[model samples]
Target: MEFIDFFILAFSAVFLFLWWRTCFTKTKPKNLPPGPPGWPLVGNLFQVFLQRRHFIFLIPDLRKKYGPMFTMQMGQRTLVIITSPQLIHEALIQKGSAFASRPPDSPIRLVFSVGKCAVNSAEYGPLWRTLRRNFVTELMSPLRIKQCSWIREWAMENHMKRLQIENFEQGCVDVMEICRFTVCSILVCICFGAKLPETWIKDIDGVTKEVMLMTSPQLPDFLPILTPLFCKQMKKAKELRKRQLECLVPLIKNRRAYVEKGENPDSSMVSPVGAAYVDSLFGLEVPGRGHLNEEELVTLCSELFVAGIDTSTSVLQWAFLELVLNQEIQEKLYEEILEIVGKNGLITEDTVEKMSYLNAVVKETLRVHSPAHFTLAHAATEETELGGYKIPTNVNVEFYIEWMTEDPSLWKDPDVFRPERFLDGDGVNVDLTGTKGALKMLPFGAGRRTCPGLALGVLHVNLMLARMVQAFKWVPKPNEIPDPTETFAFTVVMKNPLKAVILPR
Candidate 1:
């Protein structure tokens, strides 16, 4: 088929779906929560489109005026926004079994490569639950984390040593880029049972960042009619994705070659033992789980790399920014570490657990800048009541978590950077991972889909922060103010990356 002809066909298909949805499909949900008046056909699209930042921020403002729950329209989609923890709990935890299923997806199939991810993006079902079970059992078990202590220690030392060197000529290290590279490398090793060299990860981070930094929904994603239109961005994503697939595929093949040749080494380590997660799907066995096809394995790996790279990296960048911007806070934390470890001198998992002040710094950073700003689009599977309004089946819902975390009602001086709030009077309940509830500081997100990599992420942030503070003295340039502006993207980046003079103490 000619490109134009294919385009025409795809447009006709989606146009019909939209037309049918508008004319025949039930449009009204009598029980749905109230929303700002929307224009016909466009719904509330104009309001958000004109001023997305100010408009989304209006949700909590509306809640204060309207109520905790209210409906908002974005084009043809109906979104229910809930701010109250009580309501959020009811939906995500109480009625979770029913609503946990992800809403049907369109863009994910066309633009995203990680199709049908189990833990992060999978629909709530047997497949999703099964994958979660496997992850918890094989990867996230406490014993496994303890075994990976050496991995954490090694990554942290490299991050610190590398930054210490960068502290010389640059005066300021791009801690943000370094953080992303280290985390991506760590997760690759964990999932694939082998480590891609640091340089390999550093190489791919730039491409992946380009792919993520584009905030506009891919043309192929937004306008259903555009798929046949010879899209360049889609083509760009494909070319980049192919390069990534090429890099990852060889590693899988090599592991297979090694295992087949009876060169198997580690059994106790979950990774690269016999059938790594990569090996399972490649072999179509998945060990304890049933057959997961090649597509499934590739999808899982893509999700792993992206998730590990963005979340761990963003948190670390924020932690460093906070430390540099708040020098007194940094020194106090170093003193706390000194008080506990004294001559222990090692920032191990055990030592990090004792550094309560260090934990607070990370938590504070998370509150200020959530990684996935929208928290990975959630949806309702069936009609449900929320905040006294009945929501219809298959409607999309989003919690403006950025709004929720920053709302004046939920936090004291919500804008200020303060680590002391996280400190308990007894100083023992410093839940750095936030396995317990943190009403306002949900950078890793909340509920069932809360980041699966939370343990590793926490270890990365705290260890990196502790070591950086202990090893170096960071000072802002004499006349320049720290640029706190962050690039608004999938994960936030410093709009003007943090630049400061550093002296190895």
Candidate 2:
């Protein structure tokens, strides 16, 4: 009887120890940030997924409850949201190398990126560096941008002519749609070295939007085990890829053939002194990955077009919306443009720099209506401390650009649309790069992964806005006020498309 008692006691002790280890020791991290309590196995997925209409809207309330930096578990993935600009500077700029890599993509994103072949989604390594370097030196450099100035001018002319036609025919033009068409035309010209017909541009734009929608987070992304149940999404992704290839492959191949023959293509949009972006890609040879194949080339070009068109269009649309709402601000901008470039003068690259108020208007628009709510997710390469909180290796860190830009702590009257704030104050010398100090705003992001298209994007916005305000007077339609309510597509866009009357000045 004593022997049986001893065995029972030992077995009970062992079971208790195992239970404690599994339930307590292994469940929580030692120094994780404070966040809302979540359910077993799912974490905060349900709470987050429920707010899918505008998930970004929840951040402010979360910030109020959890403080500046906090954590949320999305199934098995840990997400750390950093809202403080100082902390953002520390993580994305000070310890940039530590958080330079990207987390694994959702299944649909994997397919859309063509196994991460495009520069934006490519892993941070030799391939990404090579691709980004190629883009900066060969395409986005000041000299290169100057070379491509005519493309923007030509695109603007087309945009103005179309606006006039639409205004005459319809009385009020859908500014959002016209902006998309104009931006896409410019990107198409740069990407393929030719001004494609409207039909081809519309086809590419349609496929691009479809692919972006499909790539948004789905059930299978958080629970990979459920991928088999999401085969329909996979099929749609493949179909989108096929449609994109059908439209893009022919252009890429034709450009490649032209370069291969050692003959400069007779395209009006191609720069006389340098190769087109597609031609530059044909010459690129990564360290491990050899020269890009046809499909890879197509993917890269498609990414360029989509990235350039979407965010710039959104920004320009917001600029117009704001200007129409605040006619006084619009008139001030018009006065500045007239003083610098004159009523009938062309707004060239050189002239754009001379328009300080125009620059301020663009800066203010970026601050108030940032195109993206979050920067592309950056993953910690190893366990580290951020804002004095422990961040585990492979954890996703997202910087909320909209929140940072509008943080009342940083800017005075952040909600108000005031361009003069950027003109005569501390913001007068605010640097977008965040190199000199803490970033006041990151419209193009900051650090090693800063957007390679910053100069081009800014130039496009400045010139387009200058010409539009100079060419016509923008007024809200009768009994219809311009609503700046935002909705998140791939880019955050105005919930209602901006529709207004454009009277030629």
The prediction achieving the highest TM-score against the true structure is 2
User: Model 1: residues >4 Å from true position, as ranges?
Assistant: 1-21, 52-66, 108-114, 211-230, 263-290, 425-440
Query: TM-scores for all candidates?
Result: 0.85, 0.92
Candidate 2 structure quality by residue, lDDT tens digits, 1-505: 6988976876566546645654776555558788888766567888888776566788889989998888887766778888878888998889998887788988888776767887888777888899888887877877777777788888899899999999889989998788888888888877777777789889888888887788887877765655755688899888888888898887777666665654545553354324578878887897677988888888788887767888888889999998999999999999988898789998898998998899998999989999887888888778889877888776778887777777777798888989998889647888887777667898777787788888888888888889999999999999998888888898889899999998778
Q: How accurate locally, in lDDT, is each candidate?
A: 0.66, 0.82
List clashing residue pairs in candidate 1: 7-228
> Would you give me the overall lDDT of model 1?
0.66
**How high is the lDDT of residue 398 in model 2?**
82
Which one is best on lDDT?
Answer: 2
Kindly give the stretch of ten consecutive residues in candidate 1 with the minimal lDDT sum.
425-434
**What's every prediction's RMSD, in angstroms?**
4.4, 7.5
Task: Give the per-residue lDDT digits (tens) of candidate 1, residues 1-505.
Answer: 9999976887677767666766687557687877788875447766776775734445656777767777776666677777666676667666765556675555534345455555776776666766676666555677767766666666676776777677676666777766666676666666666655666666656656664553245433333444555456556667766766666666666666665664545432334454355544454443345676444565676666766777777777777777778889978987887787763488777888888788878777877766755656677677777767776666777655676567677667778888887774312353323345544445665567666777767776787777777777777767887788766666666777666667766
What overall lDDT, based on C-alpha atoms, would model 2 receive against the true structure? 0.82
TM-score of 1: 0.85
- Number of clashes in model 2? 0
